[model samples]
Target: MDLLRYVAFTDDPSGGNPAGVVLDAEHLDEPTMQATAAEVGFSETAFVVPRGGGRLDVRYFSPLAEVPFCGHATIATAVAHAHRHGVGELLLNTLAGEIAVSTSASPDGTVGATLVSVPPRTEPLADGDLAELLAALRWSAADLDPELPPRVAYAGAWHPVVAAATRARLAELDYDYDALATLMQRHGWTTVDLVHRESPTLFHARNPFPPGGVVEDPATGAAAAALGGYLRELGLAPAVLTVHQGYDLGRPSTITVTIPQAPGTGIAVTGTAVPYES
Candidate 1:
């Protein structure tokens, strides 16, 4: 079981969110995968099992349990694959849906990966659920950004979309981890997408992943992709947007999202990943 450490959304290994990626995970069982993720101690570790015809079955595991999908880990896995096999397209069959990823090189020859997420949908949060979520996070209705109302958004996994009125409110992530985790577990939510709009195209984000045994995810590609869909569905932003995250955590990373304002089409999330060596 070789665990490769990589950081997605940044060219530098020290930046972005660190993830454990197993390029070939054929023999590992469920318990073994969980244990490996726990030992790796990252937010999420991706296991890729090769199927026939250039298709791969991908599973994501955190220290605590299996997550339906994870963006950073996907980016790390694709970057790792690009290093071994030349840049190209790969079909990933995830628990959530089928994801199509393409790898390319920048002008400076930096490998970057862009994943097209499954079609997204958003629904207004139920009254009871929103109350419970606010109580768990210790945030009142006043703290939320009025422009981006609370909604349950889904790209691959379900995430309760909450927007902060200010960047400081988003940065000061003081939440009851256990309480939030219990609430999320009950509601089947992957993460609380806490975001603040710096501008129409530029935004800041923080994701609380207590269920995954992580305080905050530095760079969250999943949430970014979901946000793009959320915005498109709500007519919030233009088709293209850039999200900056992990700055408050001191691991600044960037995720670019492209939405074509089309219905029943997946949004694209683009980022770069680099290998983290000892």
Candidate 2:
């Protein structure tokens, strides 16, 4: 299989989360795709099979397993496709659902992609689930932001949205890997979206993806989209939000989220990605 490496969410190749893109994965089997993703050693790798008509069949894989949907990989794949097919609208059929993406080249020569997720949903976090999550995160109920209550949010994949009262609390992220992984697997959660609100429009985020066999994900697009749904469902956020992630890990990624006025509408996430030197 031919593979291309790119970093999503940042214009600099060294920044953002790195992903492996297989543009021609039509013949690769599930095990081959999984093993290739493991060999790539990135948070996730995207495999694309062209179905023509500006549509593609997309799949995402982490080092350990396959996920229903992945935000960064989607962005990476869209931009990579744009590079070959010319920037425009593209449709992706994923396990989660169909997603629409648009790609373009900025005036400064940076390539960017915007993806609209499937209709989002938010659910109240079960009391027992909250307790277990806090325990695994080494946090207590007091550490939480009262204004933004806990919830399970989904835009393509499921994530537990927990808000921290202070940036200090959000920064110190030492968690029990095994415990969190077990809980995440049982609950079918892709990541835990730990966030700290800096303002009405700006927030800081960290995602622990133990189930993916990664200690942490520098930038998580799916989590960001889920967060948009969570905020909208709770009526806690404005229509536009900016998420800053991977700062602590030194990758520093920026994700722009736009929530429409319509209920249950798809969230749009925008970011730039850069290809790595071969």
What residue runs in model 2 are displaced by over 4 Å at the alpha carbon?
A: none
Give the range where candidate 1 is weakest over 10 consecutive residues by summed lDDT. Answer: 47-56
lDDT of each: 0.89, 0.94
Q: Distance from true position, residue 224, model 2, in Å?
A: 0.7
| Candidate 1 structure quality by residue, lDDT tens digits, 169-274 | 8877889889999999998888899889989999898898998899888988888888888998888857789989889888889999998788768989999998
User: Cα miss at 199, model 2 (Å)?
Assistant: 0.5
- Residue 116 miss distance in model 1 (angstroms): 0.3
Listed in order, each prediction's TM-score against the native is 0.97, 0.98
lDDT per residue, candidate 2, 1-278, as tens digits? 78999999999877898899999999999999999999999999999999999999999999999999999999999988888888999999999999999999999978999999999999989999999999999999999999999999999999999999999999999999999999999999999999999999999999999999999999999999999988888887688999999999989899999998688999999999989643
Candidate 1 runs further than 4 Å off: none
Winner by TM-score: 2
Cα-based lDDT at residue 6, candidate 1: 93
